[model samples]
Target: MASSYVEELLRQLAEERERADRERERANREREHADRAERKLAEEREHAEQKLAEEREHAEQMLAEERERANRAEAKQAPTTLEQYLRLIQQRLVTTLLVESNPVNSASGSVTAVNEKFYPLELCRWDDFEKQLERTFIEISSVFSSRSLFPSETDILGVQRELSPTSRKDEQDIRPFVRSAIEKPAERIVRAYYDLTNRPEKFCFQNNAYSLEYRDPETEIERRSPSKRRSPERKKSQPIPDRWGICEEEGGLRRVCVGEYKAAHKVPDEEIRQVLDTASKNLFLEVLWRKQSGTTNSEQDKAKELVAQILCQAFHYMIQSGLLFGYITSGRTLILLRVDEFAQQRQARESEAQYAPATQLATFALLALRAREMPRDWIVQAENCGIYQWPLVPNPALHQNISLQPQTYGGETSESSGENDDPNDSDYGASQRQSRSQPDQQSRSQNERRRSPRKRTERSVGEYCTQACLLGLVQKSPLDVSCPNFSMHKRSSARGKHPITKDDLCCLLRKQLDRSLDQSCECLDRKGFFGDVGVLFKVTLTEYGYTFVAKGVQKANERDLAHEMKVYSHLVPLQGKNIPVCLGSIALTRPYPLVSMAKVTKMLLMSWAGTSLCYNTWPEGVDIKKETDKTLQTLAQSGVRHDDIRQSNLVWNAERQRVMAIDLQQATITSVTKRQASPPVLHTRKHRKIARSSSHIKGIVI
Candidate 1:
């Protein structure tokens, strides 16, 4: 039975071996197939690369050949001045074989040339050649002398002459003709060349070779019209009087006859001068009086017409003086005007009148008021008046007291007062004094009556208050004294009556209280006499609780007081480097607050310091130890040379002890200092002695 069992086990093993063989064979076959496929793809890629390279070479060769052919074609063509050269070459090449076959008809046959070589044709017509030459000439001329070929000045003058009046048009046209004549030499050379070489040709066909013969008469017909004939002149029409008038002809066309329309005789100089003087005076009065005194629209219209007439007279005067630049007559009015430059001078005169001086205006008003006796030179007299003064007084008493200067009008005689004058001015002075003093007396009486009752009540109240306190034998507090238990009392005692809740106060205290103060104090007891160090105390009341901070020093100074306030003011509700815990009367000052240092550090590092903290102490999901390790690693990598790495400055938070790099004025970011160096290595060795060998040797010797 054991043998059979062993045999069965051996058979099972063989079957397993056969299965392993089949699996190995299948894997090997897949790998070989993959290899063959990769080899075939590589070969196909190589073949494609070779084929593309061959095509690129072939394309380059074809492009080179095409460029060479273009170059040869361009070399055969030459620039020519004659218009018929291009057409002649094309016609000769196209009809050359046919022309050469009919040699007997050469004299009368149509001829053309290409490259200065003749072509003779028996069936070709001279009219056809002439037409082709004409068309070629026109095309060549257009190509050579395009629209831009004409001089700009000549073109502009031609257009202007077309639009000018008939009398001026002839003169404008003559300018361009004169310019064209000056440039005739160059034009003649071009014309001669065009006529000689651009004409139709005759040819001779001798010994089977094409040759040129005498030229044939061109068959082109001139299509331009002949010049018109001029008619003889008729007798001159009779002249009308030299006066300006507008005439309407039969077709309703209006014609201006200036000669017939001229005034029969010039208006008399004296009459014209009188009209001008009247217009000027009216215009001056209208402008000046309208400005001073308001007038109706009808009056203003009359004033404007008079001004227009004055302007017309001035314009005519300018024309008569030969200073008029131009004239334009519209109907009855002949506006003899000057250029804008000369008109500005006239405008200056009108503007001076329009904007008369203040003294001139005042003088005009005075003259108008005293029109009966006012002289024409009153304006000049007023201008010469050195100073004019007007006095204003509250009463006639004061007015009479002030002296008046005597007036001198052109050194004229003075008139004495008449019998109407009074011996005493007492009636007038008394009336003026009564009028001025009445209101003041009434106001004073009213004020006295209004105040009497309030004064009596105030005096009674004062007597009653003094009597009441004296009767009770108890003193009343002064008004300036404040009541007890007031919130203002604490504020006044600590930081003055001003509110201490302001942001500037908080900021100032926080910035100033970052340092300590030293103070000295002497103490005496029954047991012994001793000197005590006066410690500086900085206290701050925050949202959480009151904190009493003590700085251990020898004495207190101004800097200590400032530092205390600075640190105390910046303390958060429940945060800071050192927070005081209130234990009954005595407060226990902890090294740091139980607040998130990382959050406080972040708040302090922010661009604005007034924002709230973004972290909390004992924060969930925070690993303080891991974060501390990371911070240390980062600090090491950043080469931050930290000196004050104590628990106070390095606050412990839930996630991390935010390292507040304090006292940076003394610390620098540099290589590690001696205090931060690594510990030295120490080595110890274990000893194994050979004392047994010496003892055995001694026993053997015995």
Candidate 2:
């Protein structure tokens, strides 16, 4: 206020200035307070956010624990079937032997797994089993020599370990060495039987030869491993089998019998009806007996009786070993047992008219016994055969060593001998002398010339017509020379007695209306990677497409296929998730039977996993690294380690929004802990999707 009116104005001006200063100070304090409030709000927000994050983490952990508990409960509640039990036992054995010991459960787990496979241990009663058992014992004895019949050598020479006798009952866990030893001899005998029967192809044994043993009787029972001291007794002894056979397909030699050998013994019953009832036990039992001079009939009868008892014991072995078609013998009596219903029916038919037990038992001991009786036509031929007689004469054309033409049952000699020793010449000498006097020889020669057929200079259309007929083409012209229907004519002339070759069979197929009767059809297309493992083909099916990987007679490929099949089969529990579904396998033979085909190709049919996933094309919202880690974790849980986890081997399913692992042919089954060694992300490329931070930032800037 302009000097607040002079004097009063001077005081007013000072007050005004002081008021301005106070206002400025008040504004400053208010601004400071506002800044403090904003800082406090930001700090509170950060603390609240951190607390929320921790809660989220804690909740996630709880959910995971709950899921784990549920899974454990479900597993415990699930009904353990015979097949599942068998698979469990197999998995345990394979895991223990082939994988590391840390991740796997203790030895007690193996005992428990085996116990589950045969919980009841009761034999399924079959009327045919007895006859089949007896026959198998006889057949095995006949095939295996007296020297190879017994296992005394193996039992005495095998590895031995010391165990505490007092703790035997409490020892639920079986040492790898101990379990292997217990099963060795029985397996060797079984293998020998399969080898002799020429049926090793039908069975697959474990890759490792089992070395079972007994407790060292020499070791003191009271001696125990000293605490804090390494004992020499802790060393494991490995005893080699007297004879061990290895599976060329799989490189292991464990005691467990698998594949067709296992399949043959898995019988279907009320309790176990899931598996196919194809049990045709190939049981083998041999009883060694030395040759005795003039053995009495009574002694022979006793021997027969002993064989019968041995037959029962052999049957027990068959049940235990899980085999169906086998042989049983007691040095003298050999019987072949085919446990299928057809064999049983045949045996019944053969024995229906015969009433002697001695005769019945004797019949059971015959080798190469047909499942069906001999054809009636053949029986008639055998009954009506007659001997023919020929006159004997000396011949000039015969060698000096050769004597007069022997009296024969109409058997012929050499053409030169016949020409020189012509019977007609000797008989017709008088007639010839008379004809030569009358010039009738010239007339006869002219008549012979007229009767002789003219020779053909070239092949006619008739020969070509056969090929046309093979193609199922009808002859267009009736006047054309009609060749004999080779298929029909051969069948009629042979009367179903002669065996038809594969070529003949193919030719005969043309007569049928249906062109595709074979189980495996011709490959319509072949494409993809052909490597040491197999040749992969792209196949088009009626409903969907598939990858047809053909392993053509390559042992390594076969092994890989075997490994794949094993892995695939074991991962049945993981279908429709991380692994491509294996449709099945087709064994394509080269227009011949498996035994006769020189080269056969095995084609694995798997569901077409659309397109391979790469770093560049990882699906939207899908974390490739996280998903891969989860997949690897699942595989590890199954004791599998996918060694070949490459982009090419991973397929993307757009609909499922998942990645599937393909080409498990090169995969390995290993311990869970061991699996950790294999990286979850196998290969990294320089693709933009997974570029480094610097590159990404630069790219963004650009």
Candidate 3:
């Protein structure tokens, strides 16, 4: 209030100013408190958000760990490698070795045929074999294990074991107990053999179980008709082998070895002994001298004839099959026999009945010379070079021309115990000992006989014939100097006119849905590999019984196939050289069902490029890297570029005998158009003047 209340007003104004200051102080305090509260709320929110983020991260990590554990568990359950397979089979073999054991001792039979020496194979140390297996497994498994269509099963061994016979319980039963017990197991072991070493799968067992065209036991009408006129050869039973090894490496399955099985009592130990005794000498003398010897009993003479007839039968099979590797197994006892490589046996189909004996005698003479004259030391050395080993097979020229040596054995052979199933059994082979009987020694009675009239005595597995020494010999494939099957270029030479024309193939594929192309044809089996853009199936056909690999692609990737067919056409000269024979291409009338393929409109038919090439499947003497380089160079010359180059793309064409190039899908072609170049333009005065007019002088035309 105005000045007067001036004295009073001053006092009142001061009081009012004091009140305003107090109110201002109160407002500042409220604002400071609000700022502090807001800061505390924001800090609490950030702390909660950080805690939530940490929890989320921890949950994700737990999920990842769970997935890893599951994968590891799955991997543990299925055995993948051959090494693992070996362990599994080893146990099964041991368990089944003597499941239905029956002992029947055969009476001692006389042997008139001498055992001939063969390429002596050195026994492989089981430990060494394992190490070799490990090396090959590491190198090859990483590449082929995933894409393999090997048809492996966990219970394959179980199925194999069940194939044994349970009917023969008698001690003297003369049934084929071997088929169930030993033969099946033996075949599996041989199948596993390729994996145990670096050897390629050159052989496949052809057992009667698969290939035999069994007919009813001789009918009364057929038996009575033998004497009837006009005996058509078709009525006769085919001479198919009980067990034989066939090489698919040659297009047609060719028998390379034979096996004969008998009861333990059928082939006597003495017969076995005599065969091995003359392994490095003549065999015919066994029969000749024993028959002439007055000391031999009638029973012994009968035994001699029994063994002779059996051998003669086995020999005939070997001759006709065009092979010399023959084995005689009687469940318990195993006799691996190999004949001389150079000897010429007259095939029954090739020779007249009257001339057979003379031809056989000539064959025996050559075998006798090889046994008596081959140097033992040379054979031992050849074993290292993989030359002089059992089944000196395929061609003689492949191994050096060194005349082989035959080693003889001494000492009593220790029979492997029934319980001993060790693979690395290092049973030492017996060394040679002098067997010259003193000419002055007097003959003793049968009760105490030392020198009998017969020249040969009973012997066991000895010298080079020991099982240990035969492993290497069996690995090599021998060849004759004139053999077309062994020639590298034989693929082109051996193939006849294209089995089916492309025009014919198109018509055939049109009928694929009905499962019949040619008459009487049936799809026996099929195995397939599903690829990213295509599919491949190995189709086994009946009637002809030929197996072909059919490669197919959907309409989307048909362009790739078209380009591949064109590439194959350019590579026509290389067929049977560095690639397989492309039988040609076809378009399916219908969409073929493959992995996720609703429309497989393209098909490619080609020969098998053997198996995948790797350190394990590599053919001896072939350097894959060098071969690959050459293959690429050849492709370049043909004006093609293989955009995809890898070891996996190269295959071993076993039948064609070459490292083949495959999977030409990613390839690009440099068109080999032969258009001529235009003639060079000549400089004329008019053209020169025009050029001078167009050209301006830069600065000064020095």
Clashing residue pair totals per candidate (backbone < 3 A): 22, 36, 18
TM-score on alpha carbons, each prediction: 0.14, 0.22, 0.30
What do the candidate models score in CA lDDT, each in turn?
A: 0.24, 0.32, 0.39
The predicted structure with the larger lDDT, 1 or 3, is 3
Model 1 spans > 4 angstroms off? 76-97, 100-702
Q: How accurate is candidate 2 locally (lDDT)?
A: 0.32
Q: What is the C-alpha RMSD of each candidate to the true structure, in Å?
A: 54.9, 38.5, 30.1
Q: What is the lDDT of residue 58 in candidate 2?
A: 96
lDDT of 1 at 61: 86
Give the candidate order by descending lDDT: 3, 2, 1
Residues 582-693, candidate 1: write the lDDT tens digits.
Answer: 1111112211110000000000100000101112343466564564455445444444433434322233321113422221111234543333211111000000011111
lDDT of 2 by residue, 36-133 (tens): 99999999999999999999999999999999999876654554422232233223321232212333332222111111111111112133434544
